[model samples]
Target: MTTLRIGNASGFFGDRFSAFAEMVEAGVDVITGDYLAELTMLILARQKAKDPERGYASTFLSQLTEQLHTIAGSQARVVVNAGGMNPAGLAEAIRTAAHEAGLEIPVAHIDGDDLTDRANTLGLGTPLAANAYLGGFGITEALRAGARIVVTGRVTDAALVTGPAAWFHNWAREDYDQLAAAMAAGHVIECGMQATGGNFSFFTEIPDLRRPGFPIAEIEADGSCVITKPAGTSGAVTAETVVSQLLYEVSGARYAGPDATVRLDTITVTDLGDDRVRLDGVRGEAPPPELKVSITEIGGFRQEITAYLTGLDAEAKADLVQAQFAHALELSGLPRPHNMEWTLARTDRADANVQEEASARLSLVARDRDPKTVGRQFANLLVEFALGTVPGFFVAAPPGEASVYGRFRPGKVSQSEPIHRTHHDDETSLTIPAPTEFRGLEPTSLDAHSPAPANGRTSAPAGSQTPAPAHRSGTTDVTLPLGRLFGGRSGDKGGTANIGLWARTEAAWQWLRSELTHDALRRLLPEFADAALDRVELPNLRAVNFVVHGALGEGVAYGARFDPQAKGVAEWLRSRSITVDADIAGSVNLDDFFTAEHTPASASSGSDAAAGES
Candidate 1:
């Protein structure tokens, strides 16, 4: 079977600077770069407001300029969502750059995803930036039109891979299964080193993680692909690493996209040794009738102040600061903030060796519609009480003026609403139509027990003993951290966060399914006591994913929590102690798994570490 090698260079706007040159040198058929995220759109919007010609990722332009001659000399093609809020502008810029570099690379751009002008009419409220999620066919059309480089705005990240695969295979519009399989491959490599070993929960198991290489998908005509990295790369690509990326930021079995809905439950992962993992048996369904729109708006102004309380009377010191701050606000004669939240983290220890170890953190976050409420006046008020209240009352840093915060919300419109179009170098526009056949997405059902009932009760109100699982009746239980036998991956989806936990063996999976119930999770993580929760089981992957709604309030841009994106929430859950069967725990050999190592052939001895952020 003929295979198209698709490699990812840049995952986000600030990814490794040299990845594009590296991937091109690796001789891949295509290079895809994903630079836009939910928060990125908002940041670009602010940039565009300041300067009209600057909403796109500028780093891509520089990379292309530096490597234009090499790319023009190779058979490799470039596809990137770095166009961000302005595909047409970015395409024109690329053409200008190519001309200046003495290269004639054909650049094409896909647009019509921007919905800011028609937002209110389409029931999407007034937002700073609004872009609909487009399918991959526009990219396919551009590629078929003989464009060597394709620029897109706000398409599904997977479209970079699916579009190229469809174009290469001449797939029809209704080739749902093939498109879904390609989408799975795209999702794996969309974050570059993530599909490799960059953020694997079992990081200790992989060797030479420093400066891991980006991932590539050897996609075949039938939609099956081997997820692997370039030979002599630093990172390891195994079944476990691929599974970790598959579960990251996903909710249920039905992973819906603009082109097709993927049945994540049907997918099977096979390790083919030497850093190659085969993904097959994927099933897909018809595309949804409506397209998802990401809308970001300026919610309000926010300011924060953190005070370090050391030694004794930590509680009293926190109380004194809160009371003083409230009284100061009242006396300032300024309007009160719309919302105020205070958190006291007791990180101090008794008889600590260092002063830093004996201090707790008391933070105050204030938000308001009017900037003056949380602006310089608020900071000055907090500083006024530095000498009057609490012993050793000092802030971590000087509070700055309030800054604008953004809120993200999902909107939907008819798939045909946006005039999807491809602009070629010859000044011709090709319109791409929406899918003729559509289906409403339905919740995926599983044979296992249903998720905990939605009673809005965080924990069994104060006295009722939560019943234990029936499977644990006759087994000897030992208290241990969940990370001892399981691995987890987590990320934020708008305002919600998802944590996917998987076991290494079948027996461990059986124990996990029975022990980690909805109530059990709430009991373990009391911080999510009031948030709405939903749990789904994927028996094929031996994993259970939990979705916590409202965990990040409005979104990552809103700065609702300390760890706003919830990237480390899974690690926090893994640290929580839980009771497990001794047999299941003793059967696993974590030491052996961590000790086994295979050194990379051409590993670079550099200090630059790659982060796995989506």
Candidate 2:
């Protein structure tokens, strides 16, 4: 058996470089560096503005230079997407560094995702904001280029290791079933050393965490890799830890990828060889024909304030006083929230009767696209209820600490823009070169067009607030951030657009009607309201099946389309009152689920599909 040593240095782009060096020192077969975050794409987009040619990402090249000549070739390679928006530039830079070190190494550039060209003018007119996918096959090409250190832009986070392993082992592209198997192995190992106990939280004890080495995946042609950490490290490799991590990182009903909509249920784990567990049974559906780009728009702001409310009968007093304040606010024609997030801290040492004075926070879940509205309303609420029983249950609202939050959606920039996904198949044939001259490379976005220029000193575009005049001649609609709307695509990032959140009862919508424009909805919606909502019998409340004739958004009642009316309806129906939901988020990794399942007492509180709004 050929043994390969692999390691990862940095946890993120802003992480320490010493980790990689330590891994090299520890004799890892390959050094994999993970430096991208869910929000890193936005950061790279910003960086590209300042130096279009340099593009957005430059961390990997600089970091690699720091360890150059010092790193001996024990088959230790650097794989990272710290290249961000500019993988080609980083690849070129790596070659240059190798040349400076007098090494005649071949460098590979896996170029294909900068979808920036169509960003300015695609999809009917709305602009494309951020465009990137775990660029597939690019890493394999880079392996083909003989790159000692490979850098790429937003490739599938897992493929950083899997692709290279596949390329070196010469895995066949025609063999997708096996390719997917290898890809699954990469997915397990992508989070750097996370697979090998570096970040496992269930450990009974940990050792030398400060200098923990990276992970290694000695993947075989059969689609399994030994889940091992660097030698001389203080970590345990067991069946429990790895499986737990796998279960934790993946969640939701669907996991979208460039090639397939993979189902996590297909995965299985077995403790086969000594200290080596076999990972197999990962299956994938063919990828969507159109690539999705996340388009973020200026939504508005949210304000929150925290307060410590403890003493004798804290819950009783908090609940009573909270009611007082809420009643007062309701009378004043203002919204009153139900729950104050209370976190218990410091034990029972300092409380009077309760002996548990937990700190509670009251937050505003605003709908308007204006920060000022949230800021002002929160400030007013704080003053009126800061010290009383009901509303006085919380205080410390951020007076004016309001900032803009971006609302994101998906749209296509191109029809399968050429993406070079590179993976390593074997290690024996890999070689490194002294940096060489790599010029004429320019950073371009795989997205369709340039996002709204952010370099200008202009603040967020002023929001448009057309006074529809409440109780006007329009029906109300609600949009819940379920499924894809919440960025819930596999390997995409966290945030599934609600992907859940539907009423359990059809009649339950009636209780929602006082706050909802059932009358107007009747005119706009033909099937439910306008068509006799009173008689519309709902099943499990899985979905409203709004036959609004013209409601929902536009003529897109059939498909997911956005019309001004739909936007208005969405904003209208999101919420007419302040409420808190239960956290139904499953045990599958870090995905989110709506917590409030008890609205009308007839809903199941959970739906697998994404709903428009509650």
Candidate 3:
């Protein structure tokens, strides 16, 4: 069977710049980059509004410039979604960069994904930018037609991998199984270091995490691939790592794409040793008729403030600060905000060496439609409480003005709408064919079983549970942070967020699935106690994923919460102490898991690391 080696260089817009050169030097048949995230579309739309000729990722040009000789000298082909809202603009930039490097690389671009014209008619608020997700065949066609570089806008990230794989294998559109397997492979590698131990809940197990190597997929003709990183790199590619990325940002069992729908529940992963994990058994079905449409509009204005409280009565200090800020807002004659976020982060240490060690943080965020109301009202209120706050109180930094950005919305458009166009160059163009068979198909709905009906609890399959320890008759129990026994990863899906938690041992898995019910999750994090949550089990991976509906109020970008994207939701849950069998707890190190850096719900200096916010 023929094997194709594919490497991922860039995960998102601001990923490590050195990854491209590193992947090129590693010598792969195909190199792919994923830069267009849901939030990135809004950013690119604003950029395009400012310059007619620029909307794509300019960093791509720099990557080409730095590794031109390595790329041109090798036989590897490049496919990337750095085009953002403008593939033509990005393609042109790549050509210019190539010329500057004394080389003329033929670059082809895929378009027609932009749905701004049709979006105007939807009347779903003002459309800042609208794009339908494209598939991989267009890229395959471009590569088959001898285009060394293929740039695209708003295509599903997996297309970057599947397109080249389909071309290399000469597979037809109906090769759904192979395509689905390729899609799984692409999903695993699309996020670069994510599949190679970055953002992993069990990150402590991976060595040298400070500088983990990017991922590469060694895909075989049988649709099975071994995920591994470059030699001598920092990270491990174990089954746990692959499973973490597999469940990230995903909802339900079926993961929808333009070309084929992947049955994530049917997928399997196995450790192949030597820093490689094999992925296979991915089933496929016809895709949904509609392409996911992302539209961003003028959401509103948002402002936030961080205050530090030190010494003995940390909680009391936070309480006083929160009350004073609210009173200040009312006294300043500002209208009540549409949504207000007041989060208290406790970071108090028992034996403190510094003032920060014995302090907590109170974060205040306000959002409103009126930009002036949010911006000026917040600025004036913060100054009022500067003198009235508790003793030893301090602002993290000088307050900044509110920011006005686009709000994200997810919708769908008919696949047959002829909304996409592909450009091989200025002279050649082709229309991307929409799926003919599966039009207007509704996706399979996820199912949940409640174990404790009175508490609105969900039950996992009995077969999914691991058997109790055979040698012991009775179980001893201990209380410890959930991170000691389980690893988790979380991400946002517009207004929804998913957190996938897994156990390192069978004993732990049984304890986790039984004890961590939806109600239990609510008890751990009261902020979303009333919010609807759905849980499902992946027994093979010993993992459970919880979907929180309406977690991100209007949308991720417009959400009022400090952690709008819900990236830190799982970590926060893991930090909570849980009662587990003493046998399972004995295997984990409690001290390392409970560090000052991992202090429960603690505020940071100005920066919101949890939200990835400035």
Candidate 4:
């Protein structure tokens, strides 16, 4: 078989519950699901602590129960990272479910990613859950041993697709280019509907996003693939959708993974009609010597209250409440919280139609190691001022007890440190060997002033010589939202946030490359003015990406910012108004930029094809 059809069902732990059945019925050769995130690991750790056999994703079993017969009757195989922290345990549950369903399905599982017990010994601090990322070979071993269903604990998300591709194609470790292509394809579909139309920036352009279908990758033996979805599905796949997902949560050009490092700048996206996008020419390099490990631990307890200040004197009301609350806490004999953050949002209007429109919000968040410091005692203290405080002062809701929050930190372990093992259905174990050859990747850094080569390769080697910015002369400019001519995608990577902006046409690309510099970005998003920012250009895709360091103080679970995951950061950037060349803006049809099948003639030239050529 030269091509394999792999469909993704789940993006995160709580994704659509019916996606599994939907994909299985769509007639794909394989089905894969991803159910882990930094926050998810912490949740699973808590579950396992309560009951040892409950660490894995229980939703996977429920979905399997409903689709076991349909899957057993078809040639399609199932693979997922739903095994989470307990692949062995989930595998056992799957076997029991198969027996109860009167189906003789063979189940296999890959393990040895968990490193919580040996964390301290390895010089990694004690964490609630510590798992090293493994590669695809272990999944290959299980499939080759005749297992129809495979489960793994903490493998790279791409491994779900790359393993199946490797098994069907019989690829060797040395085939870096092929592996890299598969890795790129995997990354695109791994987030399920995000590749279809869900969370898309230009959602208004998509005809029907009511119920977006999960994405499917048609992978060929050579590693290139076409991204599409089930026929007649609600969502439509276009070049813009694929491009958005390709840039989601990524940093720099070298996308390092356990299997191989993919050159993000090398991939080319072509829009094929009827909701299909082809991704080709992706290049890959040797796997890094170290595997990334996610270490999650309980940070502390936190409690918060949001009070509404209605009508006049909003700022003065806010100040008075803060003073009263502090004095009251001192009188109550309760120790002050270690950290107290107050934010007063001036959302009130001077002459509004309703009370809600004329009210501002005052939010106070308290965090401390002692639960009592931020628990019922804290709530009682805050409520005491409800009657004695400023007029028209009432909280959004009654204060609740403190809840524990988790902290996520990244660690690294030697590729050989974790024993990659696969347990077969026939009660046998196989140990997969680590890659003997290793390559160290240089830290990625790009100079914004460096011009992209004519062939369109925008990535430069680290510490490369820099040149002064090229000054271009006069053009008619118009002020509008950046979204008028561009689409953006943003996501969180631990504490850092990445925003990727792409233009639909070469003319827009030319304007974007000259404009939107690092200083220009600081002026647009003042929140990151003092934060360290790294900008990378991908001219082949007509795109530029920015990474904002420390944007999220300690990752999602820490709740450092209002939008903890930073999913909307790109949309925020696109909403900013900027002056752009009127000719470039006129060349793009704002309504058709994302919906059209082909690039507009006015925007692209014959030279566009050679932009990224080597």
Candidate 5:
């Protein structure tokens, strides 16, 4: 049996490159790198727009160039999804670096995933808002090319390794089961340092972080792999922490399509001897039909004004300023139709004493169609508001200091764009060109904001993807009625609700938007129903993000971890209705929210809305 001892040099985007050398020294069969994130993608796209030549950093490629010969000589393979938006460009750079390094070793350029161009070509013609998808074929072709190292684009994080193992062992093309097993392996190791201890929840106990060992994957031919830090490393790899990391890998809720998902529960974990855990039994379904499209346009200008408002009776002075600012906004001569929210922040400290500089900071955030018009008006408004007030002055507020915030318009891409892919018919048989003279290229210093570290120990610019590779094979229609959106017994402090819903690409999202924003989904609830949906962020999973602001409406999430109000809101919602199951965390969850109560499994079949009414 060919021992494919896969090693991991880096976990997320920004990590240490020196670990690649350490993995080489440790004698692993292969190495993998993961790099990509939603916010990070925008960040990279912005960088590329600013300077195409500068967007794709040359650090990792240059490092790989220097060690290409050693890695090729050892016959060890390397897999990386370090290719973000510029996969082809990154590969070309790496190839050039390899040629310069005097390493005539094989360099397979693997990448073809850019949904931006095909966003609306595949039967999807909506106002595009956001775009994000994991890679599949990018990883496969890279490894298939037999390059000493394989670099890819925004792989589902798991697809990075799944692509390689499937190609290496020559698993059947439709063998999604084996493919998923490999996907699990990639998911476990993608967060290079996190799998070890960087973001470990139990990090307080982990010792010797300075020389912390990155994550390594021990894969058996059966498609199972155990993720563990290096032996003799300071951190401990327990099932508890690994399980947490596994869940942490899958972020938010939504990805692009089905087949693109990597299910978490499918993994069978068996702790082996020597602090190693053998993970097996990863399963997958088909992929979704549509792709996520992201379009960024110019929003209005925004500036955060932070100043110390110190004076006698600071709280009382701040209150007077707030009242005076409101009065000026009401009559500031400039058009006053613009919406402005002024908040007097209450500082949280051990002592309830008010600070001498207690005052309000105005964060004027506006999103208008025209930046120029808003900027000019904002300049007049800021000065007018300050001039009308008798409490304080800004720490040198200027006219053009207002920064422009980019507004991201998200929608679905055409299904025909082929956003999600695995392996395809190409290899009939190719052979790696024989190793020739290796010429090393000049090494480039890593950018401070580079997502990942030097060689393998780097982090991604956008951190990395949250690992929630569930079954994304088929798209099923789902319609959450107005009632189901409200009510839930959660652990929010003052009755708040943290809700999550899973949907297919059919009319699920559209229907949801209708109910929540357009159709008054919140009106369905009666008691403790006066709540606002604070933030709607799409993290990792191909799911919905609904974080209620005040009532905790039912539970606590990103805003409030465990506020009593949010918990009460969730429980109240649960008591009032039944249909969607709750995935609530914290101490205030109602034990009976998910009892035998369930609504129509198929929402399309019914027209009646089910409410979590108590």
Candidate 6:
């Protein structure tokens, strides 16, 4: 089969709108967009509650509506998870939009991924939405039936690319290696500009990031592919950027999808030069018997208040603010919430400087089953501190109204259940078959309580502890920030967060693996000392990924922590000074070499740093 060029436009629901048009103009064979994340499902469910026709990603349809002719003319097959909780409704909306535009694109919608009924049995609160992460088989079937555009609800992100690749290569269920390769390619480009330089640790090196081009994967029949962007796009694709993204939010050596189990240990990345990173040697195993099901349900109400502390004694002032607030709450005779978090973030820079630079923040968050407890009463109690608190005291912003939040619960369902169905534009639909054999694929990082492998390399699941690996020995040593020797990337998966740390060289990797043991990690971030923790080593990528189970306390939307999604987890770790060999610590040349070795993919690009994580 010829090489398949797949381009990804939108990473999340509200991604760059111009990406689709850019992919279309770039002449991609297939265009895809990943519009769903764990929290996004809950958001969509809330939207569906307001209006049944409003559940799907409006941006997906808007992109298609604006670029339907361009996409149809370029002979590009469009696939997106924009269907959210309503794949049928999204498909119908697209069909209607296409008709109004005087176009007749054959659109297909994949169904049966919704597991609301099955989830109800667990009694896991009032479910907002229950979705099973589906595979690419239905998409392949839809494409076989001549679907110009395919809409899916909750398929794995990589399935967007693997589906087309499977259809193009006629890959069977047993073609594990090839399928694994395609899945790797999909994973690389799935997050749009992430394959470029969006959230790279060494962001100073990449140039022309003003508007980075969306990522494209050029995959061959063998499964090896070059990850790149449009020729004139802003961001650059290099080994470091690709590796950074590869480690983002991943658990261990294995990355499981509904279609296959990809072994990250064997994955290899090579700089093919000229804005391309060749990905190869991705191996695969049979997928697990049960598919992952995301269950989002109404948790309760939450409210937060922040007080600013500046200049001398900022930490002391923050303490006073918290004390006064608690006293006020007590004097008001108001019932306390179920849970409360008081955090004093010392962002104050050292030495004499502007007050803005010396300012610290004291934040208080409350969660409860009753709205009144976390609502106006909570806000009023915080304001009472303004008069009696320390000097230079002020609220960062108004204590806004309390908001409803959703709790994320990860579960599994037998593959045989949740029948897969695909509806074609020609008024035809069919049930896609489930694999007969139970592959018994080990559960994903979702099962934080699972025992770790006996190898002692990965963390002891979440609650368990493992013996610490030996620390590296060196005669001459110096103290420097961890970022001096390692680069890191981190993000959330439901209530869990994974931080991926990598070294530039083999020697560095060895030192990192030895020095960054489970015990070392706990020492560095004592805040999560008791939180469930697991570490996975990826020697092939010179990286180690640490999964913090239940770190976010119910997930981003529901979590009251300041860094809810753990976006700053890696950055925070990097800022901590660590002892290292004097030679390694002083090797500014090594850092300089890396800066120049990997060129940016496109013109200087500007991106919303926070939103780029997903």
Ranking by TM-score: 1, 4, 6, 3, 5, 2
- For TM-score, the strongest prediction is 1
* Tens digit per residue, CA lDDT, model 4, 455-502: 422233322222222334766667778888889999888888899999
Q: Per-residue lDDT tens digits of candidate 6, residues 218-285?
A: 98988888899999888888888888989887886568888887777667677766788887767777
Per-model clash counts, in order, read 0, 98, 3, 2, 126, 18
Question: What TM-score fits each model?
Answer: 0.93, 0.58, 0.87, 0.92, 0.61, 0.90
The C-alpha stretches of model 5 lying farther than 4 A from their native spots are 1-3, 50-57, 120-134, 249-261, 271-275, 291-300, 307-319, 326-339, 350-364, 372-400, 407-416, 419-614
Give a tens-digit lDDT track for model 1, residues 179-237: 99999999999999988997788888787899899999999898999999988889889
Q: Provide the lowest-lDDT 10-residue window in model 3.
A: 602-611
lDDT of 3 by residue, 246-348 (tens): 9888876667789887766656667766788887766666778878888877787887777887777877877777777777777777788787878888877
Show model 6 residue runs off by greater than 4 Å. Answer: 122-125, 441-475, 586-614
Candidate number that wins on TM-score, 1 or 3: 1
Give a tens-digit lDDT track for model 5, residues 1-614: 55356777766456677877777777776777665544345556667667665344345675576577788678787777666666557766766766776665555544435555554564334321234454455455556655566665554666667666766677654555666666666766776665565544335555556566767776666677776766776655544345434544232222112234434324445445354666665544344444444444334454433334544454665666557645665675544434344443443233345743344443343333455434655555556566555555563355554455444433443344433432212323222221122112111121011121224221222222212212234633232232233221122212334453322221333333333330122433332234444322221111233444443311111122223333233223323322221221111222211112311133211111101100
Q: Model 1: number of clashes?
A: 0
Pick the winner on lDDT between candidates 1 and 3. Answer: 1
User: What local distance difference test score does each model get?
Assistant: 0.85, 0.45, 0.77, 0.84, 0.46, 0.80
Q: What's the residue-level lDDT of 506 in candidate 5?
A: 19
